[model samples]
Target: MKAFQELAETLSTTLAAHGLVLRGGFNFSAGEESPTGPSNAPAKSVLLVGQTGSAPWPHFLRWWERQPRDLKDPLDSWSREVIGAVAYEFGARAVSPSDRPFLPFQQWAMRAEGLKPSPLGILMHPEYGLWHAYRGALLFDREISIQAPENPIHLCDACIGKPCLNSCPVGAYSADGFAYETCLSHVRGPKGAPCRDAGCIARNACPYGTEYRYAAEVQAFHMKAFAGL
Candidate 1:
């Protein structure tokens, strides 16, 4: 079998064992530096990104919720561990963006590759809604070629009301963009209702992922962590 096929199988087995159900539409691109030219970065040298499910992220989410307001630094370790495993499997490294070494993937997707926009941004998938978060990414060392699908399966195309855009209490998300301060203030207020309890109303309003329900308790846990409540 080719390296790409092997990598896919290995990823499927590894993530499935952890109760993560890998879906289609995982777009892989070449890394910044490679033996071959940028245009020639084989599909094999890839970045693995997918949504969470099969095992609910709520267990982790809930733990994050109850953490004392001041002690959340430990969660960063968990993030590294999860992202690292996938990187190792692919003989690649995990790149989490920092203040330095700003990522070019988003720009590459838009300018060079010609994706209309980020897939998740459009509410295209019915299963994940907006509740799903892109937690980690994996990068491979070598290049390999895989067949590209003819067209992207955009799940958000059918929705008319676009509940995700409207559901937010603060209208943080819209065609325009997010208002970070407005969202942060609501979640952080001493007496305000916690964002974790009900979840991000806008995210919850998505019609996708019937099987992937965001439990309220889990939502509250995430909210408290995010809001520092």
Candidate 2:
């Protein structure tokens, strides 16, 4: 059984090598404790999450520059390759928690050997604000012991501007809560002011993630996914 500290160091180094910055709350667990749908079988695993940095644009540019200039619309192969490699290397399964029901899936991940919150949303680093995301997650079968992630600090709590809330042209995200349908309509190319450019302006205005900006193509990809396009 590989210990958690050993695993963290390995993953942190790997992500750093790829230009990603490892934020707080790098949670890991045995495969026996991971999220699984009611019908989906659970597997032994561990999860590693971190910010992909401010410039995923360069990643997109590099991917784009790889093929013949005439070829357009890069394939999903690149994402699959990146994600798959992480999964294989870590002796764990990999996935974004959002791929399933948000709350339940997260709970499943936190159930001791199941699933757990990255300590105070520690994985939810304040710097990238919420603009960054866990680009990939790995699940492993081996039991690896890791130190508790650093206690998380909610950066949003300190912001007077509350830019993430105000920046939304559509006002999709409200302190009261999100209006998903309205946001969905606008991103799907609905006639609206806020989401015209693919996502929430408020999110873009977030100072935390200014460095780890999402590439335009990644934003488009996410917007299309959100819109169910």
Candidate 3:
């Protein structure tokens, strides 16, 4: 167990410098079900890896700029290179959110942290609001003891007026559900410059963890990716 803890700590510290954190994890040996069903990778446990706020944006941008422009999914490709190297060093298998046999990351997150979904369908983090994101996971052949985070206060429940529902001009988010096509159409239209340049208006309207909001450039980058611009 000491060795496992040490390994986890080393990986956690190394990832922290790049603004990624050991979000949560579970041991399949302890009878915790596999979120990805069955895998032949000899994984005995899985560690959830993610980022909060915009701390990684600058570093990612610098690294991304240095990569060949012709490469597809540069961000995901870069993440695979960095995280995969770490997994290799630790004798673990690295998996990404973009990987096939698509792992149920949202389920893994909820089970590992007791997190609830927000109005926009994204997991509502207590400290990062909607600004946080899960990037990838590391699958180990040995079980590592990991403590689940206590259930946090659902900030959305207490929010009066639910600004996220009203902030989008195209009514992309509402009580009914998100209007995916409506949003995409609006974002690709002539009037989409604001959303294209600054990210989703509804997401920015969330009051929780306002301090962790991404910078304009970072937000714009994400918007561009979402819009395929």
Candidate 4:
């Protein structure tokens, strides 16, 4: 336990310097299959890494300014570079949401943090609301003492009106599920200027984490990327 705490502290400090946070972690349960790690060994534990609200905005902006404008998926690439170094130094293996085989990040997050998906599918933290994300994970060969969050709070349950469900101009999200082509087409045309200039209207309507909402520039950057502009 001491060793795990020490390792977590050291890694958390390093990640903080880069605008990332150790969202949380957990040890694999007995009989559970674990993620593959160094040398193809099954990892015994994992620490989820990510950001809250605009935590990574400024840092990512600085890093983005240094890379070529045509750089593909700069955010994912940057996460790989930074977390990969952290993994090397700590003798752990790095995995990302974008990795091939598509590790079950959403499941891992739900288990570690006791968070459930909001109507928009982003994990809704009682504190962060809809403004948090899981960027990467660090896999370890040894078990780490960590606790799963308790008494999980699903804010959407108490959120009457559910403004998020009604804010979109194209009615892209509904009980039937998301209309992907509808959303994409809308954002790609001139009719989408407002959505293109800002972030998702539905996302913004989620009032739980108003204080943690992304800055205009940060939201604009993501909007452009989502619209493939």
Candidate 5:
């Protein structure tokens, strides 16, 4: 147990240098779906990697500035490179949310952190709120002692106004689910400058974790990407 804790700490420190955080981790249960290793072996444990707010912006910007400007999905590519290196050093298999077959990353996050989805479909962290994101996961053959931490409260349950659902100009998010086409059309249209320049209105409306909110530049980058600009 002590050794595992130490290993986890070291892993945390290593990720921190790259502005990443270990959102949480968990060991697989019997007969559960899991990520595979080189030999098609099932992973016994998983550690989720993510960033809080703009924690990774500085590092990403510095690295991005060096690469070709025409690269598509730079953020996703960067995440793989950084997290892949960490996984290699730690003797783990790295899988990304963008990976084919799309590993159940959202479910894994919920199980690992005991977080529920907000109205916008992003996990709501008590501290980080909607400002954080899970980038990838490290899969290990050894069943390290890790499990999800439970948070007693779901922020949405207590939120009365639900400003997030209402802030969108297109009403993209709703109980019926996300209107992806409507959203995409709106974002690609001329009126999208507000969202493209400042980020999603609904996401920016969340009152929680305001301090961790992305910087204007970071938001602009994401918005442009989201709009496929």
Candidate 6:
């Protein structure tokens, strides 16, 4: 147990240097109920791994540019490579957000961080808003003690105007649900340049965690990715 704790501490510190954090974790020893776990593996715990804000973007982009572009799903490939290496070093299995039989990352994140979804369906982080992301996770074959995060105040609850809902030109997000086709069509249209170049206007309108917002370049990259541009 002490060894595992030490390993966790070391991993947390190491990952932080790369702008990744051990966001949260859970123990799923035999007989424990969980909606998401390795179906074919003897996993006893899962560590939620992710990044906050744009701190990792520059580093990731730098590495990404150097990788061969011939491969499909470069971003997912990179995440799998890096996180997989970490898992190898630590004697665990690495799983990415893009993996087949997709792991319920949102559920894992909600359980680990006590989070609630924003209107955009991205988890509303008290300090990161829509600026954070889960990259991958590590599944261990032995239980590791990790405390569940105390629930933070849900920012969307007290928002007066809900600017996020009002900011989009196409009404892409709303109480009814995201207008997927509306958003896609608009983003692919002539007037999409601003949205493409500056990221989602609605997401930018979010007042919480303004300080942690991604840089314009990072935003543009994500926007392009979303638009398949």
* RMSD list, candidates in order: 5.4, 6.0, 2.3, 1.3, 1.2, 2.3
Q: Any runs in candidate 2 off by more than 4 Å, and if so which? A: 1-3, 16-45, 54-57, 60-77, 98-124, 189-194, 215-217
Q: Which one wins by TM-score: 1 or 4? A: 4
Query: Tens digits of per-residue lDDT for model 5 on 1-229?
Result: 7777898899999999989998888899889877785346998888899999899999998899999999889999999999999999999988999999888999999988999999899999998889999999999888887644877488889999999999999999999989999988988898888888888899999999999999988998987887688
User: How many steric overlaps does candidate 2 have?
Assistant: 27
lDDT of each: 0.53, 0.52, 0.83, 0.88, 0.89, 0.84
lDDT (tens digit, per residue) of candidate 1 on 1-229? 3866776677777766544433332334434342222233433344434445325354345555766656644345445566567666556566543213555544323322223432225333334544444444555434445554444454566678877787677777877777777888877765347465667777667677756755676677667767766
Give the Cα-based TM-score of candidate 4 against the true structure: 0.96
Give the top-scoring candidate (lDDT). 5
Q: Tens-digit lDDT track for model 2 on 18-98?
A: 544433332334343445422245544445453454444466457767778555334344443565666567555556544
Measured against the true structure, the TM-scores of the candidates, in listed sequence, are: 0.69, 0.64, 0.92, 0.96, 0.96, 0.92
Candidate 6 lDDT score relative to the true structure: 0.84
Better of 4 and 5 by TM-score: 5
C-alpha positional error of residue 25 in candidate 5 after TM-score superposition, expressed in Å: 0.9
| Per-residue C-alpha lDDT of model 6 across residues 1-229, encoded as one tens digit per residue | 5765787798998787778888888887568654343444567888888898887776677888887876566667767777888888787788888777777899889988999999889899988888889999988876786766798999999999999999999999989999988998898899988899899999999999898898898888777888888
- Number of the candidate with higher TM-score, 4 or 6: 4
Angstrom error at residue 84, model 3: 0.5
Order by lDDT, highest first:
5, 4, 6, 3, 1, 2
Best of the two (2, 6) by lDDT: 6
Clashing pairs in 5: none
